[model samples]
Target: MSRTLMSLVVLIVAVYLALCAALFFFQRSLIYFPQPSAVNSADSRLKLAMPDADVWVSTHERVGARALIYFGGNAEDVSRNVPEFAAAFPDYALYFLHYRGFGGSGGSPSEEAIAEDALALFDQVYASHPQIAVVGRSLGSGVAVRLASQRPVQNLILVTPYNSLEEVAVKQYPWVPVKWLLKDRYESGKYAAHLRVPALLLAASDDEVIARDSTQRLLENFPNGVATLKIVPDSGHNSISERREYWRWMGDVLNR
Candidate 1:
């Protein structure tokens, strides 16, 4: 065979092997990320809202208080953040939602499944506490926006949010043809554009995972005055909430 032909054959084989390796090692790419069960606090605030699915939720009760439903990022153990959320909004009843396949929740994770779970959890919280707010961070922002657009959310807060997973996938894998392969289309941009409730959009100026432009786009797409934008200074994707200003803004949003 010609030398060029042999090299072409070797190149194809190498590319094939690389693709297989990526599929094997990055299985989490197939679905939303999941966190292992953490040692929950002995606070005994959690209960199974979805009995068959074993979805665990931690609720902080405050009489006549507005209920806040929290949708955490893909990698976050949402229920584990209950203590912090509880501290942040002492007046509101806080509900930390554990997405499907995370914590004690059963089944696998998908964009639709998480959205469904968010709706169910929202309904559960709304049953007793009529006034409700929704807080979603990163990927959870998609879930929250979808819920808010359809449900009766009094207030909406999004932290380090993105336009969509498809947008992010294209940014990271420019040549991979990810639009076809990506099953989870957590498309917040579309829903956020039309959200009628009061909203707060928090973006980290230096967020690496969810680009600054994506967050900016999502915020800009929001309805006028229906949303307020806060750019957290010197913060990145995971550490945006580490700032004092973030907490201050969060306090103001919840109080509003």
Candidate 2:
């Protein structure tokens, strides 16, 4: 090769490698977008004392055996769901977890750390409310799926869930080596296979964030008859919950 051509080639390779290095080092920032909690009243908040972090849960207390635990999207403030969820499921106690570093929670978030916190939350909630139903939306879907797999959850609800975070990352950054660079691969599909309870997977008809194929792939992982997929009509990924049918479907699963 000519000297000029060789230098250009070297420069291009260096730039590509630098990009890869940057992605590897700062990938979590791309994955998690922490948001502040909106509802932070003393009565509604639950402080979960973890070894590394103090996680906060937005709760609606109800004296009953049934309860619903929610995990929100990466950038979502789960506390925002409080009023609607309280009115919709009045019989069931509601708990919406604000992930580590999200809302008022301390410490950084990772797949493993969030998983541990989820399990802890379940254990605590399950003490009084044995008939626990878990709901996870977007990124929280992965956390909920994994939690249901390990815990004796009564029902599982996944909203706009993908097969795996790695697959989504791969599609998002087609040029980058996402599989190798990803540190927190939330493989919901892998855990879905272990779930024995009833599961409801809610998909948006016009979801641009999570591909339809990704939701389908995750549904395929579940055992036959254990899970069902329902697409909310005329809705997008973030707007799925706005539809009345979305709550209806969720109510059907949780109530059953």
Candidate 3:
């Protein structure tokens, strides 16, 4: 091949690789961004209300053992889990937070924005309820860890979480440069390590999307002597809630 032609071809290949990397790192924005839609919770038995910033909350009871706030996965409605949570902690009040653009909430969704919303919700909930616990699954883990680090939380629970979305992107697209390209660095792993409250980290053995090691990385960040790590057998990323042991484990944790 001629020298000029060879050089041009190499340059084109490099540009293509760079573009692929950009797309890979920001893949979640490309994949998970969806317009918020108002979902009907009229039939829900739990008392529903929106106190701030396009977020919806479901409460089981005002007077209970403790208040529980739940953050859900990227595609999770979260309100759907109200019944299950109420069943699990019937005495304690249950709260579900809708992300900026998830489930009829206003504004666009971003990692920092969601974390701010979580902190606001935590503050609002904590103002009245002294005993507060935070629970998060998947993408919501980012919000949970951030809130725990910022606030005085009684307990923290993370399910099917990753160290960071950026890390996950790199794993999914090894050819891509995720570190520089990702706009939303949901670095839950970085925050989880410093939490002082009791923490529960749950990993799925059969999670095909997020590896167990990634979840372990988040667990490792937890401060010494206060973390409980559990691996659920035969459970995938989405099926952790379906397992009977999940409820039993949570009951034990809360009781502890």
Candidate 4:
């Protein structure tokens, strides 16, 4: 090769190495967005004791035997979910987990850590109410699916869920080797096969983030008759809960 051509090749290789190193080191920052722990006016906060970290929870207190535990999106402050959860399930007590590093919870967020925190929280809540439902939206769906697979969840609701973060990451960064670089895979599909309880998948008709096929693929991963798929009309991934009939459907899931 000519000297100029050889020099160009060396530069390209060096740049590619630098990019891969950055992706390997800082990929968690790209994956998990830790938002400030903002509390809503209607929320009453509680701290659940975990071995390594303390998890903050937003609650809509209602004296009842049935309860609902909700996990929010990556950037979502779970406190905001209180009002809607209250309106949707008036009779059931509500608990929304503010994930680690988000919403004033202690420690950095990771798939393994959050999964452990979820199991601990579920065990504590299950102590009071034997009949409990788990609801997860977007990123939280991964955590919730893993929780249900291990625990005795009465009901499971996944909104705008993807099969795995790897799949979603691959969709967004086709050129990058996301499958190998991603640390917290959050492979909900892996846990779906083991979950035996009734699951309701709320898919958006026009999801700009998670594709329709991504959510459908996760639903298909579940065993026969284990999960039911519902599409919210004229809705996107974030706006699926904004549909007029959304609460009615969600209420039915909790009430079941």
For candidate 1, which ten residues in a row score worst on lDDT?
42-51
Clashes of 4: 1
Q: After superposition, how far is residue 42 of candidate 3 from its true place, in Å?
A: 5.8
Task: For model 3, state the Cα shift of residue 63 in Å.
Answer: 2.1
In model 3, which regions exceed 4 Å deviation?
1-4, 7-11, 14-18, 21-28, 31-39, 42-53
C-alpha TM-scores of all predictions: 0.88, 0.99, 0.87, 0.95
Q: How many times do residue backbones clash in model 2?
A: 0
Compute the lDDT of residue 188 as modeled in candidate 3: 84
Candidate 1 per-residue C-alpha lDDT over 128-159 given as tens digits, one digit per residue, 9 for 90 to 100: 88899899988888899999998999899999
TM-score of 1: 0.88
Q: Which sections of candidate 2 miss by over 4 Å?
A: none
When 1 and 4 are scored with TM-score, the better candidate is: 4
Q: Could you tell me how far off, in angstroms, the CA of residue 152 lies in candidate 2 after the best superposition?
A: 0.2
Give the runs in model 4 whose Cα sits over 4 Å from its true position: 40-43
List ranges where model 1 is wrong by over 4 Å.
1-31, 39-52
Please give the RMSD of candidate 4 to the true structure.
Answer: 1.6
Model 3, 53: alpha-carbon shift in Å? 4.9
What digit string (tens of lDDT, one per residue) describes model 3 on residues 116-217? 777777777777788898898988878888898899999888888888888888887687666767788888878877778998888888998888788877
Local error of candidate 1 at 196, Å? 0.8
Q: What is the C-alpha lDDT of each candidate?
A: 0.80, 0.94, 0.77, 0.86
What TM-score should be assigned to candidate 2? 0.99
